[model samples]
Target chain A: MELYLIIILVLMILGSIYSLNASDLLSAVISYGIVGFGLVIAFLLLQAPDLAIVQVVVEVATLIIMIAAIKNTQSKIPKMEFKPKIAIYYAITLIAALVFILIFDRATGCLSQFGADTMRMAQPYIDGAQHTKSANLVTGVVFDYRAYDTLGEATVLFTAVIGVLTILRIKGKKEK
Target chain B: MIIYILCFILFLVGLYGVVSKRNLIKIIIGIAIMEYSINLFFIMIGYIEGGTAPIITKGFEHSKFVDPLPQAMILTSIVIGLATTALLLAVAIRLYQKYGTFDINKIKDLKG
Candidate 1:
């Protein structure tokens, strides 16, 4: 029953997104909304209600911000349209989707055993960890086993913000 | 199976939008779509068939409990997504204020 519902939901999402190709701004907006909502639903169905909540909230903010930006930047500028060969694109995409589905199914089946084994082996670590109070294995992995990587990632984000602000500040000074 | 294929298709369409669209906002939409697709993919990864909710109860045994780890991982990812989208929108707003247009073709003042 759940599988059938999932299939229907998937179809609805695909149909809505495919409709985004229409050369209409309203269609684009509606399709994007559907896509975003579908993603949140997909997350919920996949046992990640936390992600679903986050995704929905973030997506709403993103769409609103983008729409505001789009409205502000309103102009009579011509929209760029793709002129790809329709048949070729469709055929390629269909084939690619099929191949991707097949690969995912096969990989999932193969990885299931490995995942169980890994989980069993890690049982001891889970049992022994003092940080189990955090109630998050990925968090434990992030801040413990790969603290260096997390630190580097933080550094990168900090650097990016500083760089962008510096550039914008220079531009502001020049404009004044 | 079909759900997996549909997700891939959605991703491809978003990719096409990002690659082919010249409007900055459209490109941003494409990027947002891609982020969503990945988020969905990650969620799907942690699901167990016929899995019960991960709530603990006294003296109750459940053989089919969903893994809650991916949900936790994605919680972080979603916040990151929010930060990224906010930053990107700010950049877009700044770009519009400076350039007076969202067309990538027209916003080529820095092309020296």
Candidate 2:
């Protein structure tokens, strides 16, 4: 199982690297889908079918929306040439970021090994779930024990809808 | 350890794209990548080797299950991520419509 996870993670990393470097915007977005869908497989392997289902559906919808967005945008701007200095700057930043994450990971060093359950906080959520009378623990956790958190998520989604509608309006305020 | 490190590297890859790329679409893609890395990391943390899903059935009422809290939190986070990505893409489209180009450097007039 761990091997399968490692393989999927490798594929995701490669897909992301390629997506980031790809010259074509469409191909880049398509490659980004690889990372998203790989995550779905990972979720399944980890025994989270609920997440896998949600992830797959959301991934497809997101892909459609992004593809539609790119359709309207093409051949407009002169291709920006990379100045040698910016490339060098990016290289430096990349290396610096790499070093930073490594050092940061090492310094924290708090995360346990994969699949090791050292949880001290989730016991009550699990042991106390019988009172919720839900067969599915995750759903019970989301919609019952933490209903307010779910409500907050709903509010964020609502806000996002309003913002998108505002931005995509046919006209932004009447002429001044 | 390697897995965690690799995940962080994936995160840095996204960060690199977000910070270094000049194209608006690429930046959005970068943000999406960053979000992917994070969601994966969170899900991975709750994994328990050989554990079943946290659904109780008639036959297996006492089966060990992976942590449900993170799963629940991540479920919401996933929706939140989708919302954010949609909002960002919408904003991207609006910017392109106004500027006629996806290049940030070229769209400098909106700097105020």
Candidate 3:
């Protein structure tokens, strides 16, 4: 199982690198889809089927949006000259990665054991699922314990849709 | 332990793309990649070995289940990511309309 996970993770990383460095926008988007699919597998292996479903749906939506954006635009980025600025960018990236890894290592200390009840807050939900009358504990927690947060997320989606519509709205006067 | 480290490395790759790439759409893709890595990491943190899905069934004994909190949190995050990605792409489209190019280097009229 661990070997399968490592293989998936490696594939995801490779897909990410390929997408980032791809010469064409379409190929990059396709590679990104590969990365997204790998993540779905990881979620499934982690026993989070709900997350896997959500991820796959969102991944498809994101890919469609990106393909639409790229359809009419230039699909190629011109080659950039290697300069001091590019070297500085690389230096910054290295420093940032190192600092992030150090802080993360110190903060987490150790990875929580697999199949362990790591979150105290999750206990109540697990214990209360029967009383909540929901077959799915995740759904119960999302709609019952944290319904307010779900409401906020809905509002955010609403606002974003409206914003997109307004932004993409065409002017009749300009058309005339 | 190693999984988390690899996830973080993926995040750094996206960060590098955002910092080094000169194209607006590519930058947006990088941001999306960073979002994916973060979401994956969160889901991984909640995983329990030998755990089943967090669903109950009739006449079945339940032993262990994956943590629900991170799953819920990630669900919300994924939705929010979709919204933000849509907005970013809309903005990218508008920028292309106004500037007639996706290259960030050429669209520098608002320099301070």
- Judged by DockQ, which candidate is best? 2
True-structure lDDT of candidate 1: 0.60
TM-score of chain B in each prediction: 0.87, 0.93, 0.93
1 versus 3: better TM-score goes to: 3
How would you encode candidate 1's per-residue C-alpha lDDT over A1-176 as one tens digit per residue?
45753664576456446544545544565567777776666666655555666677877876776666567446444644456786687788679767876776777564453113223433443443355543444455456755676676566557656654654454355554
Candidate 2 vs candidate 3: the TM-score winner is 2
> In candidate 1, what are the lDDT values of residues B52-104, reduced to their tens digit?
44443444243444555555556656666665666676687788787777678
Query: A1-176, model 2: which lDDT tens digit per residue?
Result: 98888899899989988887787888888999999999999999989999999999889988988888889677333455779888888788868987897796886488788899766877787787789988899999999999999999999999999999988989658776
Per-residue lDDT of B13 in model 2: 84
Q: For model 2, what is the alpha-carbon lDDT of residue A11?
A: 94
* Candidate 3: tens digits of C-alpha lDDT, residues A1-176: 76788899889889988888888989999998988899899888888888889889999999999899889877887766689887887787778789999998777766674445676768888889878888888899889989999999999999999999988888634643
Instruction: Identify the CAPRI category of the predicted complex in candidate 2.
Output: medium
Q: In each prediction, how many residue pairs overlap at the backbone (N, C-alpha, C within less than 3 A)?
A: 0, 0, 3
Pairs of colliding residues, candidate 1? none
DockQ winner between candidates 1 and 3: 3
Residue B6 local lDDT, model 3: 83
